[model samples]
Structures are given as C-alpha cells and as structure tokens.
Target chain A: MIDIYEIIGLIAATLTTSAFVPQVYKAWKSKNTESLSLTMYLAFFVGIMLWLVYGIHLNSLAMILSNTATGFLALILIILKLKYK
Target chain B: MIDIYEIIGLIAATLTTSAFVPQVYKAWKSKNTESLSLTMYLAFFVGIMLWLVYGIHLNSLAMILSNTATGFLALILIILKLKYK
Candidate 1:
C-alpha cells in the first residue's frame, strides 16, 4: 500500500513534471528564450534521460513516467531555446 | 557495495542538481528574467522542497542531498526571477 511519503513523492513528481508545461507554453508563446540557459536545458535533458535509465533498471514506473515527460519537456525547451535564439 | 544503476542514479542526480547552477548564474548575471516563467520556478521550488521532505522520510541520503541542493538553487532562481523582473 502506498504510504504518506510515497503520496508526497507522487505529488512532488507531478508538480515538478508538470511545472515545465507553463515554461514551454510561456516560451513558445512569447518566442523568447532570452533568460533561459542553454547549458541548463542541455544538461537537464541528459540528466533526465539518465534518470529514465535508472528508473528502468530499478523497475520504477513513477520514475520512468515522470522522467520521460520531463525529458520531453526539457527537449522542447532546448529546441525552443536554440530556435528562438 | 554500490552497483551500476546506483552509480547512474548518482550521476543523474548530480547532473540535474548542478544543472540549476548555470541557470541561477545566467539569470543573476543577465539580470533579465523576462523569459523566465514565474509559475515554473514557483512550482518547482515547492516541488523540490516536497521532494526533500519525502527524501528525509525515506531516509535516502541521495535524495536528501540532491533535493536539498536543488531546492536551494531553485529558490535562488525564484528570488532572482522576482528580483530581476
């Protein structure tokens, strides 16, 4: 059974994972990636990919799902950063 | 003994945690957060804080350390975003 900590983790994951949506929307809509750091997005993308791998190794559905979504969002921001730059 | 997946997870945690540094530096240096989404940072800050709590509850050193550092960094960015706005 899922406990309180797991529930907190799930909520944390949801918030952090979904947090990128507004960023993507803001950047895509504004067509502005000026304040965004290219290095951050690049590293974040790679990191999320690694976390996805780690999740797979651990057989964790939560990590896999969250990292996949976060990675995709970070990739979009990276592309947007480069394209909009 | 630590295994390969744990190593990968460590590296992933390091990368994602450190990734915020460049962003905080960029925003502080540029003093331009026009493109940075306030909602994103706000949600991310809260999310990371929650993750830190979850980590502590789980007694995971890795999650605790990484989330603590990442939370601090995210908080700085949030402050910078608001300050430089």
Candidate 2:
C-alpha cells in the first residue's frame, strides 16, 4: 500500500527525472552546449548509476525507473555537450 | 544498523547533491548562460523542493541532508540562469 509520502517521493522522482528533457531538447535544437558543465554531467552520470544500483538493491521500482530514465537523458546531455564543444 | 547498501546510497546521494556545484561554479566563472536551459532549472528546483519535503517526511538523514543541499544549489543555478540571461 503506497502512502502519501511514497507518492510524494514518486512525484519528486518523476519531476526530477523528466526535468532533463527540456535541456536536452534545447541543446539538441540549438546544437549549443557551451553553458552546460561537462564536469557536472560526468559526476551526475556516475551518481545516477550508483542510485540505480542502490535502487536495484532495494528492489524499488520508482528509484529504478527514475534513475534509469534520468541516466539516459543525462548521457545524451553529456554527449551533446562534448559534441557541441 | 547501516549496511553496505545504506553506505552506497549515501555516496550516491552525496555525488548527486554535489554535482550541482560544478555547474554553479562554471556558470559563475563564465558569466555566460546562453546554453543553460531556464525551463530545466525551474522544474528541477521545484522537484528538489518536493524531494526535500519527502525526505523530511521519511525522517531519513541522508535524504534530508542531500535534498537540502541539492535544493540550495539548484536554487542558485536557477538564479544564476535567470540573472545571467
């Protein structure tokens, strides 16, 4: 039985996960990623991967799904940053 | 009793939370945000705030601390994005 707090966490996860979309879209459309920090994305990618492992450890669907999606998006951003540079 | 998974979670939290700092530093140093997506930061800020509330509800120190730090950093990024634009 999912409680209110769990729902809140899921919402948070969803928002944070999807938040990367616009940046990716902007970067993709503009082909400009000068302002995007490569260091930040590199660290974030590692962090998200760790979070995915943790989610798997806990068998948490929310964490797993969110981190997976976020990781993929973050990767694209990384590649875009490098490519545009 | 904190286990290995808990430690991994903490590391993951720390990495993701701290990841924003580089972006902030880069933007602050560069004073150029032409490529930073305003829409992304706005949504991310709200997501971090929700994560903070969820963390508080769970009474998890890792989540609370990480989210609080991340929320502060995300807010700064948002402000920098708007200000520099």
Candidate 3:
C-alpha cells in the first residue's frame, strides 16, 4: 500500500513541475522572452539536466518523470528566449 | 566503490539548484522583482514543496538537500517580491 507521504509527494511533483506549462505557453504564444534572462534559463537548463541524470541514477520514476517534463518545459522557454530574442 | 552516475547526480543537483543563488542575490540586492511574475514564483514555490515531499518519500538525500535549498531560495525571492513590491 502506498503511504500518505508518497501520495503527497506524487501530487506535489505533478503540480509544481507542471507549473512551468503556463510560462512555456506564454513565451511561445507571445513570442517574447525579453524579460527572461538567458543566463538564468541556461543555468536552469543545466540544472534540470543534472536532475535528470540524478533521477536516472536513483532509478526513481517520479524523479525521472518530473525532471523530464520540467526539463522539456524549461527547454521550451530557453528556445523561445533564443528564437525571439 | 561509488558509481560515476551517483557522482554525476550529486554534482548536477548541487550546481543547478545552487544556480538560483545568483538570481536570489540579484533580487535581494536590487530589490527589484518588477520583471518577475509572482505567478511563476508562486507556482515554482508550490512545485518545490511537492518535490520536497517526493524527496522525503524516496528517502533520497540528494532530493531532500536540493529541494530544500531550492525551496528556501525561491521563498526568499517570493518574500522580496512581496516586501519590496
């Protein structure tokens, strides 16, 4: 049986990681990322990559799923920042 | 022997999560979050909480450490946004 903590973790990961979606959508739709810093996104992108590697090492599905999705979303912003800026 | 993957994971978590420090510092020093969207930070704050819960669930030291640090940093920015703005 899954414990309450595990359930909470799952819900938390799902919600927070998914939070990037709106920002991603905004960046894409507006085609503007001038306010967003390239340095910040670059650092974040690298950080997410590391998290992915760490997730893979732990063989944890939650880490993998959340980081993967977050990484992708961050990447979208990074790309938009690049493309539009 | 410690595996390469685990080392990578540790490094990744440390670097990426810590990357927020500069932004946090900038926000703290400049006291300017006008460009920052409160919604993004709010969502990120919630997401980090979930990640923390997930980390606690997995009993992963890396997750706990990284998320805790990230959450704290995000919280700082959030507070500054509130206080200064």
Instruction: Please write out the lDDT profile of model 2 over residues A1-85, one tens digit for every residue.
Output: 8888667778888889888788788889999888778988898899899888977886656678888999999999999898889
**Candidates 1 onward: DockQ, in order:** 0.69, 0.67, 0.60
Give the CAPRI class of candidate 2: medium
In what order do the candidates fall by DockQ, top score first? 1, 2, 3
lDDT of 3 by residue, A1-85 (tens): 8667656666766876866687788788889887678887788888788888877777766767877888888888888888899
The predicted structure with the larger lDDT, 2 or 3, is 2
Query: lDDT of each model, Cα atoms only?
Result: 0.82, 0.82, 0.79
Evaluate model 1 with DockQ and give the value: 0.69
lDDT of 3: 0.79
Comparing 1 with 2 on DockQ, the higher-scoring candidate is 1
Across B6-62, the per-residue lDDT of candidate 2 in tens digits comes to: 777788899898887877788889988786778877778788888778767756566
- Maximum-DockQ candidate: 1
Q: Report the error of model 2 at residue B40, Å.
A: 3.0
lDDT minimum window of 10 residues, candidate 2 chain B: B54-63
Off by over 4 Å in 3: A1-3
For all predicted structures, in order, the TM-scores are 0.81, 0.81, 0.81
Worst 10 residues of 3 chain B by lDDT: B2-11
